[model samples]
Target: MRLSTRYLVPLIALFACSSPTTSTPAINSSAGPAGTSVSSPSSLPELAADPREPFLAKAVASLLSEDHLLQRKIDDQVSREAFPKYLEQLDGGKLFLLKEHVAALEADIDHLDDQIEAGDLVLARRGAALLAKRREVVAKVVADVLSKPFDFTKAETLETDAEKRTYAATEDELRDRWRAVLKLQVLERVEQLEELSDALAKKKPTDEDAPARPPEEIPPTFEGKEAKARKELAVRFETRFTRWKDMEPLEPAEMFLNAVASVYDPHTQYLAPAEKENFDIQISGTLEGIGAALGEEDHFIVVRELIPGGASWQQGKLEAGDLILAVAQQGEQPVDITDMPIDKVVKLIRGPKDTTVTLTVKKPDGRVETISIKRDVIKIEASYARGAVLNLGKGHEPMGYIYLPGFYGDTRGASKAPERNATDDVRKLLEVFQKRKLNGVIIDLRGNGGGLLGHARDITGLFIETGPVVQAHAADKKVEVLEDTDPGVAYNGQVVVMVDRFSASASEILAGALQDYQRAIIVGTGPTHGKGTVQALVDLDKLRANPQAASAADSLGVLKLTIQQYFRVDGESTQWRGVVPDVVLPDPASYVDSGERSLFHSIPWSSIAPQPYKVSKHSWTAAQLAEASKKRIDSQPVFKKVEAFSKALKARRDDTVVDLKRDDWVAERKRNKAELDTLDPKLSETKPRVEVTPLEESAAEKTAPKTAGDKNVKKRIDKWREELGRDPWVEESLLVLEDMKKLK
Candidate 1:
């Protein structure tokens, strides 16, 4: 609950197009008052259609200009940069807009800043209208192109990278581009079907667990497969178009405002009301809803996964893969949701706690049924900390492993103290490990992107005595050192903090602090994700200066603004260049072009005066442990295959042009699969190197299920343990821990 009201550290980034402002001004009428009228492009409609839009635009501009960390002005240069980004947001694939349409849209690009300042979104409207028109045209083109059979023998290539291509010159050229795209999609689907068919044919009757393909379900020939692919593509396109057309008015506004906000930095974004709600859920790891994660599949809102203890899970009838056809409040008519946007569908299904909502669903086997369930608080268990004991054969000492997906805390809790949080959970796990007398602990933060910043500092304090955890540099050049004043340590044992390229923000803070204090050895494939800045959600409704705008304040949404950049206690900012781990592992994921450095307009890495802090006493040095690890890793066959696969993957990523010819495409896919098959099986099918079991007390709770929801929870935990037992990274860490004990 520390510094809960201060700032939020999130893992997201943006470009500068504006002149620097000499001074930061308070939110006022510098951009003009609400409902301000100014000259705009003659072709575009007036802003009076949506009275709230002008006020929203003015508020966002004022906030960005006055409070953004960059303090950049909204000017012509920013407009020039933001316009193209806005265009990209509309059609990043470059599939819909023609060259002429793009030219027309770019006509007033330079004047977008002026339009925004005056509360007239002429360019945004034009771009949105053009995109709508292009989508209608593209839909027809897709239908026409798919109506005819493709010439599979014709040799051709398609540039899959949109950045490498330009807008089509004419309608014919656009149609031709669509033809290539459709052809490629159909080709991939046909090849996939063929591969599945081959696998099924090769499967022996003795293979009882193998999935059985009904005789009617299998496409007998290549022609039949191709036909099936085409039909699927048609349905997919129709669904996609319907979804796009159904987008709310505020969505386009959000995109334009985000483009403007991103000009200052990547993390600054204008979140629509719905997006703000989703972000809150992500940080808190809880929501009031049906508890089913939904995804779109050819127009159907298919339930992807059911959250354990959620309303859907408790209901028992609703399940993963079930199609939600309609939703209704209790005693109300069910509203058909075919081809509806996922967000809208979610909104309908999510309601107040104890409220009964009904769902009309189509089961996987095609049975239709109506289900009613009372909504409840759904806690996302995956986001919390989980612990397991690792038994490494007979010679090595048992070690404890804690997997923290994020630094989650209850956002709705009181600012001074949270009822439940990650720090408390991790502390409990550490206490359990302390009692067991575990030799070493592994804090697995592999894919943790970060959440609440307070938890990061408090979690770091759990491993060390009181000290400065991180330094925050605000926009006004003021520095605030966030320290752990808690005088005692939670667990002062040998520790290894596991990270990866995706470990970001709060993750970086904890890892960097631990590494700086020499309290833990860092282990990862590469540097952590370099997101050093902190963002805070500012409700635009509160910043309305004009009394006229107050009536519409509720719909104004929120702006996630970057307000501070944090640095490690060692003085180095983990902005672009993240914390370097002590022991670097050979991982194929390392080959990915990721992290903050890969992002555009990310803040550069810098250093501040290092804070005075005592380093914890450690018996073994990182170099000694790393040297021993490298020897074993080099000779490991799995790692060798990983190295080769990494190279192949890098090569594959570099080659953006794909062959459209059926035979050539199939051959390319085969070659790619052959390369992957070498390493994929080794990574997934390796025998468990260590025995992973739950904590003694939690074992009963995990295995003994009292309800259907608890049964699902048990299955997930067992699967997690099984996967962890087979993980090479975890195995490597166990070996490293043994080295730490012996090398001393």
Candidate 2:
């Protein structure tokens, strides 16, 4: 998780900045009007306290009430085949609550039915009153949570007594303890609520008039004015919340945590129980699916990343930013799952292997297209691999470039084959560098999301003989220094490491280790992903089966416990402090609102003990790198044009207009296209053509701008033209290599 110390300065400065002038006038004139209902912020309801008790309590109650009304309907429409393999991960506590809560509501439902049948108006009214009261309790709990936002930094000071004690423990144990707390107390509760809802839905009533119809029947379709229309449409649908609907409310921040927690460790997961079964099945390596990593970007269910060689990627039909408007199973009605949780949407898309799922996609160019894909298992062979060339420069000099996608392995069944380990691959790659008498090597770790820790250390050992690589610090304050035991430099030639934001964890470690030794010149974006902690997952199935033997809170499925946080040789924690590049380069992501710091509830930056060691300074200093970059950029045409385009792009994104009209939208799209087209003749000429129409053309048109900003488009086209001229960063890096050749 990304962490930052930038916020810490604000707290310290708050007192310094406080003054009579800084204090704004109160809403009330001279102690406010007598009986104003404006309560102080302190009087707000306590949402964090016992959230599990109330949150789950409401979910349990809702599922129970809905189940009685819709059980029969579900049993009829959805077959047993749709039922998940829930046996493996059910928590006894959660299951018990589900059973008791549903049964209690069912009893009430029966009494209501009888009263309605007998025309007992008084009794029926009384029963309705009771149900309403129960619902009020649920609503109040949710309202309390929604009233105030959560801040992760604020939570750091709110750790319980138990956490303090655990934090004082040994490194290995401390990391595990912190992870367990997050999994059990934070994630487990959310999962249980989702599972409970699905389980209780096994029984649904078929009577349409009894519960009234859901708003989805006349789905929220905004055909005008982007902002106003969405607001109005949302309000209209929300008004029908009183009635039973096959819908669940998902908090973005909470769900983001669940998705990211798993990333800390391969095995640890925090899936809402609805997705538990699907996640498990996928992990086993045999699942039918549109192999795509889906996520919500500004309320749209967007395709974040495509699994290489998957149906979508191979077809070249599905683009990374395309928004899925609708999903239609072969014989069923289309489901508009827009604004739905990612996991729930996955359920509708995935099925038995080879099943055809139709996707209605909205492309960035405002074109919509329908594509059918048969789900299949994504092969391991598809992930990037290792190989190398002996000759780097046929005429100028002998150098090599090695691309390392990531330090990956089949963790479920780690391949012992030497080819699977990145270290092994790199080792062989170095052999080529040596054999070819190369002058330098570029280790490309651009999009590598780190894998095994052992590989990180082993890879570092290949560069330097024997010294500390990275240090580990536990919450308990224990420090462990990791050293390169292999006292041999496999390839000691001038080295350059290339990275970007996607390069994280093990990638950071390798880069940091090399930088510490002054062994390589790190080149790329400002910083790598600031994920430095290691996590271990505790399988919930095993925990629940033997509750007595397991830890007190072990039944919350797999807990990806953060076991240790990494530190550089100089003692700087990489948690929030990523590996800063020696030479910063132009990155489009920086111009856009994207990066580790943009995420919610990221951890805070912290530090620990530094390893005692020093390395001889390389010939290039920070100032020299800057001077070279400036000179190279001045001479390069491509970088200058890109810089200009990036500025305009940033301005447009920052000042986005929410219009409502097809004509305006068309105009805006054309305007943007025109600007991008003018950047460079070659660049504009390279633009791809649109073959499909947008899914919601009318809706998009409503949100389009009335006046086309053709000037902006023209500028953009010119910028692209300039980009064809040259690339300064690449040129500067090449120059750096050339300089290093002189040093050797």
Best candidate per TM-score, number? Answer: 1
lDDT (0 to 1) per candidate: 0.74, 0.48
Q: What TM-score fits each model?
A: 0.78, 0.56
| Model 1 spans with C-alpha error above 4 angstroms | 1-49, 192-228, 273-383, 410-420, 545-554, 698-708, 711-714
Question: Total clashing residue pairs per candidate?
Answer: 4, 42
The top-ranked prediction according to lDDT is 1
Over 1-744, each residue of candidate 2 has an lDDT whose tens digit, in order, gives: 111223222221122211111111111122222222213322211112111222322322222223211112212112121111111111111211122222322333323222222323222222222223333333333333333322222222223222123112232343333333332222222322333344335535453111122223322322212233223323332442233123212121123223223222322234333343434444332223877767655445777556644656545577666789777786454466655655567788887666777776875544455667777655433344433332213344545656676675434334553345567767767766677687787787876777778888999999887888899865446788888888777787888888887678889999998888888888886788788776443333232334347332212222334546788887786766688888777764455433455544345567666777658456666556556766776776666667666675665555423232334534665687688666532433333221111112122122223333333333332332233123334345655666666655
Which consecutive 10 residues in model 2 have the weakest lDDT in total?
A: 83-92
Name the weakest run of 10 consecutive residues (lDDT summed) in model 1: 13-22
RMSD to true structure for each model, in Å: 9.5, 21.4
